[model samples]
Target: MIKEKTFTLKDNYVCTSQHKLYALFSFLSARDAYTFLCNWFEKFPEHKESTFYIAGESYAGKYVPELAEVVYDNNNKKNGSSLHINLKGILLGNPETSDAEDWRGWVDYAWSHAVISDETHRIITRTCNFSSDNTWSNDECNEAVAEVLKQYHEIDIYSIYTSVCIGDSARSSYFDSALFKTNSRISSKRMPPRLMGGYDPCLDDYARVFYNRADVQKSLHASDGVNLKNWSICNMEIFNNWTGSKPSVLPIYEKLIAGGLRIWVYSGDTDGRVPVLATRYSLSALELPIKTAWRPWYHEKQVSGWLQEYEGLTFATFRGAGHAVPCFKPSSSLAFFSAFLSGVPPPPSR
Candidate 1:
């Protein structure tokens, strides 16, 4: 889906930003997909009352809440013909809801992990306004950011503690076409066959191969105008073509939370891409009162990770998991999801 070209009254010309481009996709695809499901339920009355939950991870952090807010708004409208979607809650994992806070926390996280020195961190904290939409003209801030990049040059920035696939080149550049390339091949490099939790870091490579197979695509009815071999796991063209992003999702959260929608945000502790620190910093801006004190939640006899309940939100972390918690700690993630759907916290012992 594409954002239709529109005129800007201020400049008296057609204009758009990356955010506007992606927003069009969300409205055409994501929101319409929700409507289709709701209509399906309407046709099949037996499941009409079933609750729907919006869930996504990473960049979806922005999408999930926006979609939920849309659903919530639709439910409230008195439009006689509209479907009242029962959007019960939303689940976000390592979400990038606030670009400013997330990027600011990235530098702080790098410093805390010793990827950069304290002095550099101090300089960056004072000099940079990562929240700004414009490019920085300040040389000192640019130099500081460059140094931080250099420090993390060799590391697996996604999961800082994990082993990087050997053949994968260290990603030194900003988000670009390379982002799409890595999703299909990163796991295929010379990483260990398996981690302790039976997580295969190279699974993306296997998926890439499987999805591109003509037979497999045929079976799944996954034909597209793009050739199967050339269809990337992630559409780089869409990502690269994005014109801009909304400044913050905090206001959306505020609106949804006030509207009484259940909200839970979880993070895998080791994720460097949208680290736990970033999540914490972003959420802190909301300043919600604590409904429950922070404590370690458990799965079976062992501690899974920490959790905290606020007036309108629940925050949790998977102890040793990375960006994708289920990929690393499936059992614990299942437990978390079960509790979330049930409108309860994970039991202290189970």
Candidate 2:
């Protein structure tokens, strides 16, 4: 599935900060992905028949579904010469599906986990109308939300149960506004401190250090006439200027579900950023009929998590896992992914 092709939407390096701000939107990214896929099939024609699956976590909840929808639409609208992509399903972990539900869940999860005071939670739940576009504009709601940020400021908001990285590289002058943003504006300074290496909060810091090395850049061919000075896990410029983001991707979920695409949504119970509660609340809005009653799923003779299968979607949780489920619980995540690919349930405790 790996091949070479060159197509530029904005500039030579699509992620380089020097490009015009035209490629940051979700739909635009999806369109680019579709175009890339078509070009790949045309180049290799032999692998066009392979089953494909789209997977991502966090904000990719939007990207994955949007790309799948674009692929589905193009496949249906194909002419005799057009290629058909055999898209099978999608898998998402601790996804941000709906803005309203995600914010609500953030507040609720913070309060439930004892990260915030009851008074603060009461203030937020009372004053903050998450569904409204002007929620943060309200002074009372704004203050309450700010208090929530203040409470999370000291700890790793992405994984409340884990220790934070105290290294200089992990420190930032401004608050991380990757997930905490208002309707009208996104903070352009710091990106979210997303942890990918299980309990290690400094993984991105290490990655930044390694990727910035002159030798590393030369080895990766990243320094070849690109003028790339710095490499970050996320482009704050693109993130700040992102457009065409739908408030909710539930409509696309409904459309794909009806189209008979296999969908699985998993959550790491320990993730405070996009917590399990947020996923539950967002998915509950779909109201799909339950196909399998909720039950515990086991791995290696131990209870790994719980799962509930809906008519067109499957919801599961990874116990003791943080933002990166596989990093925290590789065996359990592997079992869960195996089940997803095979169209079966995770190992049940008999």
Candidate 3:
């Protein structure tokens, strides 16, 4: 009779932080509220429902994969005696798969999209490798970041051109060179339009990690409870805790594709983070028999993006989008989803 909320995913990621877990629980609780709506339709077995899709951008990209895997795996575990839950498909946006090559790929992408400048990209590129988990000077990093966007006047990581630049210190003491969504325009005022509201959610999200204060400390006290290091210590081990748990999207993609699940992996042409090359490696790793090699697709009746369709996966590029897809190009994005939802995989757009 009714349907789940159109879009309900919140900031749940694949990590193991207690505070983060608490926040994620809140997020899931909200999502469950939405999921429960669909259970109503579970009855009336003959009633056809609209397509159920899992979609999100940026971290959503990373999050949706695990979510879909859970659904698919759960569906498989049903013995002969149980009613199966129907899941339609997934739409992974600018995902941050923590692959070494994938991470480094963002630097080049940010530059190409004019998210950062050539010089700034060069500085950060030469200074630090993307895969390693290390802390460097905020000032220096910001300086290199600034140089990259020297020509753009104001650079925005969210502006479809530089989606891979989502990683950052949410509460930066001083402004850095990398023009984020917040810093696109110069504001002499200490509290700019975006930085208002006394505090920012994104700032607090990172602050809890960097300093360990949760739920907003009314009085910034010296008590051990107020100190943020304890949270940091635990947060430090998050990546280490599940050190080798980077699941390959390729194998999973292959299985689904073989099962006739229409699959597509479209990258932002400018995203060096999770660059086209890494995607190629992953797709080829699926061992799908080659059907069509690389080709191009048209947008606005002009050559737009490169593509490849093999036995299992269909790979394409968003001409100007970064890691995130639909956020950058909504029409093409909508078209992509519409195609997937209809099981109408488009011909290869190389």
Which candidate has the top score in lDDT? Answer: 2
Local accuracy of candidate 1 as per-residue lDDT tens digits, 1-350: 11112221110111122112112334444455555555576568677577989899987887787667666755775642245667889999998877667878777888888888998898878877765434255556666766765555456666678775544311212332344222232211011111111135444456666787887776776764245654344554455455334446787788788888899999988877678998999899889999999999999879999999999999999988887789889898998999999999997654
Candidate 2's TM-score reads 0.84
Model 2, 87-185: lDDT tens digits are: 999999998887777888888998999999999899888887777656656777676776776777667777888888775343452344345433223
Stretches off by above 4 angstroms in model 2 are 1-26, 78-81, 176-198, 224-228
Per-prediction TM-score to the true structure, in the order listed:
0.78, 0.84, 0.52
Error of 2 at 119 (Å): 1.4
lDDT of 3 by residue, 1-350 (tens): 11111223233322111211122432343234334423444445454244445666544444565555544544565342132346666665445443443434444555665566576777777765433334133345445543443433233433333311233343232234242333243211110112100112143345445455533342455344544334321231233233222333444454455555555667766544355655554455456777777776665565557766777556677777654555457777776666667766544433
- Cα-based RMSD of the predictions, in order? 8.4, 7.7, 12.7
Ranking by lDDT: 2, 1, 3
Arrange candidates, best TM-score first: 2, 1, 3
Give the residue spans of candidate 3 off by over 4 A: 1-51, 80-83, 110-154, 160-251, 271-287, 322-324, 347-350
- RMSD in Å for model 1: 8.4
Residue 246 in model 3: lDDT: 31
Ten residues in a row with the worst lDDT in model 3?
189-198
